[model samples]
Target chain A: MNCEQARPLLAAYVDGELDTVRMLEMEGHLPACPACTRAVRELQQLQQSLRQESLYHPAPAALRRNVLAELSAQARPEPKPAFWSWFRLVPALSGAMVVCLAALLAVTLNRPSGHEQLTAEIVSSHIRSLMANHALDVVSTDQHTVKPWFNGRVDFAPPVKDLAAQGFPLIGGRLDYLHHRTVAALVFQRNKHIINVFLWPGSEKNSAPSLDSVRQGFNLIHWNQGGMTCWAISDLNPTELLEFTRDFAL
Target chain B: MEARERLPAFEQTVLPHLDAAHNLARWLAGNDQDAQDVVQEACLRAFKFFGGFRGDNPRAWLLAIVRNTFYTWLRQNRPAIPTVELDDAALEVADPAAAGEALQTRQADAETVRRAIAALPVEFREIIVLREMEAMSYKDIAILADLPIGTVMSRLARARKLLQKQLAREYQTGGPS
Candidate 1:
């Protein structure tokens, strides 16, 4: 690959967007050509500075508040008219409405694999739990306090293990509603990321050996163990999240 | 589904990406206040079309809306600034040490880097921000930017080329902050 052939691909090469074949060809040509090497280094540095610099502008708190308020205001349905409430008392119509609701519930709950809806629910639960004063129902680093805290609140004792020595410290536990049931959410901190581990008794349909998915940039991994279905979701990278699951299960 | 019914899911899948949207909008619209307006308007548009969002990557989906909203606002509100500014001073002989200056001084301040990026043409600026700052893959960027994969790569290359020259000049001259 000479300069003309290589120059067009040089940026892609530096960006690591080149396919393996093209990348290796660039690799072979780069060291031999000083111009391309300089170009490559410059591009790499530009990319580095762009990434490392604090350039990301988070929406202002006021903006966030206003946007949500605007959405809710726009989405808010007007109050139903008085006649609609009176009409609902008609027996046959009310019976049909009940059937319509049941059908809607069935269709909503019986998603293709149940995973899609459940994943969405889990992600929302994770996000909702992160809100201030909602993350923990009982704050404790001791497994004793956290594990038993779920006993009466939820149907089962969620397995609570603190892998603080492994870099995932037990933070606390919260009750989160997901998958049509209230489940115990065990919270842990891995550096800056909060990992939410949700557990409930597994029904026959949703249990799996292990599964991994990425939803809205959050990493989620779930599996069944000891008759309990467990989902661990966080912003942590997959490898560490997998490690977290392994350590938690240990 | 009605907007009221879909709002919760929208908050879950779409709203979480506000920072990403704001970051992109901030770069594209050129100021925080304008960016907020763009975000607010884009999200309202997003809610209007939320029923059609079937993809899994809501961040990318939200970003696409933000970009489109920004362009529409740009068309209506502001006269087009020269999208491409060829730096005539960039004709000076390339400094041999300039490429390495980033490593040496880390040679620019954070503000300098931010200004350098902001100064890039929108075509180049958006690509660099998405690739470097948002950390999106080229494929995702292609989808978000509505460009072919090849275009995404080449534009990124060209953007970096211009940025390199610009930064090198800034460092070598210690150009005005």
Candidate 2:
């Protein structure tokens, strides 16, 4: 790879984004070339500096507490199985249910085989929102406006608080559709950090506090607080969320 | 496996990625509280569809959920607020400390770098977080950002270039607080 050609690939090389063949080719060329080496060195320094800046600032503890509390509130109300349809006797109902059940059955029967599909859905939703520009509906710093806005749109009222005084201000509210029902999404901002709190009815059957973390790329903080489950998602480190939640109050 | 047995496995595979999800949510939401909300919402969505997760990277899946939750929240409520400058002084980079205790924290100079990163444009910053901080591959980044792999590489390169420039600017301006 010549200087001009290798220059573009330097970042990829540093990142190991190149395949083995490309990597070996770059390696062979790099030793004989000072310019590319220098360029590579500069890129490395730059990346290190950027990495240095990757310090995470977590969501405030109170926000987690408040969100969890709000979720727990609605969680106590178990979802009554869609009023056992008299339609169950109808052939059409049975047929439709059969199809849905088949799909569900296939999934349930092969839980381990569906990890990729599940991840894709999660990623798909994330990309969809960014491209679609429907990230938030209610835009306000007042919790009052955010909390009440969801009254009719969603079945449960999400706990909303304005943390403006504490540096994270309440932005408006919006209705989100998830788990087969409308849920409340309360928005907040901390510097450049945006917290999206989704409140919905939790399963009364599984009320244990649960937590999960993934490191494929972004960091996720998912925990069930009280009866309400809260997932604090961000690229920020878990420690930051811990700090944020520590200081967060409803 | 029974739904009962499968539930724990789902939790085991996906739950470990919650912090990663939370971090992504925090960056997208631009605040701790909003990030929490996004993470919570994403978790529910993730849980409901846990059965659909096949053999794939769970963290990216969860992050994808966070990203979706953030945008969904934005659409239904407010537009994404651009990360504003908190006056140069408040963000002024603290000087490298001379003493022992402060030196330890100052060694990496991570805090200042973080603030500088926070100040970047969302388009640029998101890629940076996904690639460098989170260490996602080009393909995964493409999937996450809905961009092509070429675009991901170029964007990540550009993001790095911008970070270097920002660091240089910080150095020239006497560092951030």
Candidate 3:
């Protein structure tokens, strides 16, 4: 076969897609034809370079968590209303149970306030950043270095401090978009666990000094100081997280 | 199948291909954020309809879903960039002289290679990514790309030739060694 016939077949030939007879014909033709030979070699080199290149990006851990979380949520069995229906049949106990149920339902259905919602957002974001293996945009242990890195990234100056002497070393900071606005997420390391402290400008003056909550297996502490709302979240024990927050707050 | 049985089957069949799915999405979507979004949506769809899956090749099946998801996303998010049919003639490497520049292409760095592949049209880009980077066979690519084997082969040829031309141009323009 000449160059024209061989030209279209070269890719298949290189890929081992050709039948044996065709492969033999192409192999025989390659030694006699320099141009076809050069094309085949070029195709091989391109394939090699492509394989060597870092082209395949693994799905980030956050994506895995998000997808798995969504799958588990979908797979979760629907709440069994049959059990509740059976509980409603006892007329004598129904009066007391109905009142108790009303109070319980009221507590369960109450929507979280803006601050509480922000706390949940903070914990999820912290988990996502860690799971995504993007824990820090600027990694440093020095307080001076971590503090200045957030300049101009957010509207307010985020307070960054080193509590390494107290066992919480400042790791770095990342710019996070939370609650429909950009906020500062300062990272600190307590032993092996990471603590994400999200800071943003406070909306209310002289708000409560501190509030603590837990959600989705994470502990969160929120506080307002000097016109900034700061939230520290981690999987670390609540006492340790609160201690770290206290040192930073002071 | 019951929901419990479906979960295990879906996990066994589809979850192992998460990286492959994300890799294709990342290349197609052109960024991490969009790639993640596309993969998430694709996984949800895969789980929802997994009961209907009859094919034996789960990786290819997942990849096909990813390809479809990416297109739908492109259509909704980027209406201006129509998914135009790429002319095979336009992608042909006319200059036979560039074939000799294979040595320079061999020296091409990862960034240069990435830029060259990124410059390809979506169809060409997807084929090359599947065949070369993902190391999928022509038949498997045919399955994922929803094309005949001949079409897959010719498109791959055209894609490689386009890459050669791009690399040659880079060398001509003094791309980093």
Best by DockQ: 3
Q: Rank the candidates by lDDT, best first.
A: 3, 1, 2
**Candidate 1 residue A13 C-alpha distance from true site, Å:** 2.1
Write candidate 1's Cα lDDT for B1-177 as tens digits: 988998998999899999999999999989888999999999999988999999988999999999999988888888655446445454243553455554433445677788788878898888988888888889999999899988787677667666777776676676543
* Residue-by-residue lDDT tens digits, candidate 2, B76-169: 7675564444243433432212121221222226766776677776666778878777888889988877888887776676666556656655
Cα error, residue B70 of model 1, in Å, equals 0.8
What does candidate 3's lDDT look like per residue over A56-135, in tens digits? 68889999999998888777776566767876668968887899999988986797777777777787799888898788
State the lDDT of candidate 1 residue by residue for A1-250, as single tens digits. Answer: 8889998787677667789999989999988998788767666666667876477788889988998999998788975667768766689878988999999999877764677889999998888887775999899999999988887898888889999999999999989888889988999999989999999987545444254789999999987777788999999998899899988766
At residue A19, give the lDDT of candidate 3: 96
- lDDT per residue for candidate 2 within A1-250, as digits (tens), equals 7777787888899988888988998999999997677667666665666555346544456644554454444334454656566656688878888999999999788773443443333334433444566657877777777677777777665556676776667766666554455666655666666555555666434332222445354444444444454444444456665444443423
* TM-score, cand. 2 vs. native: 0.49
**Tens-digit per-residue lDDT, B104-140, candidate 3:** 3465677888999899889989998888877789999
What is the lDDT, from 0 to 100, of the residue B175 in candidate 1? 59
Supply candidate 1's per-residue lDDT for B169: 68
Candidate 3, residue A186: CA error in Å?
90
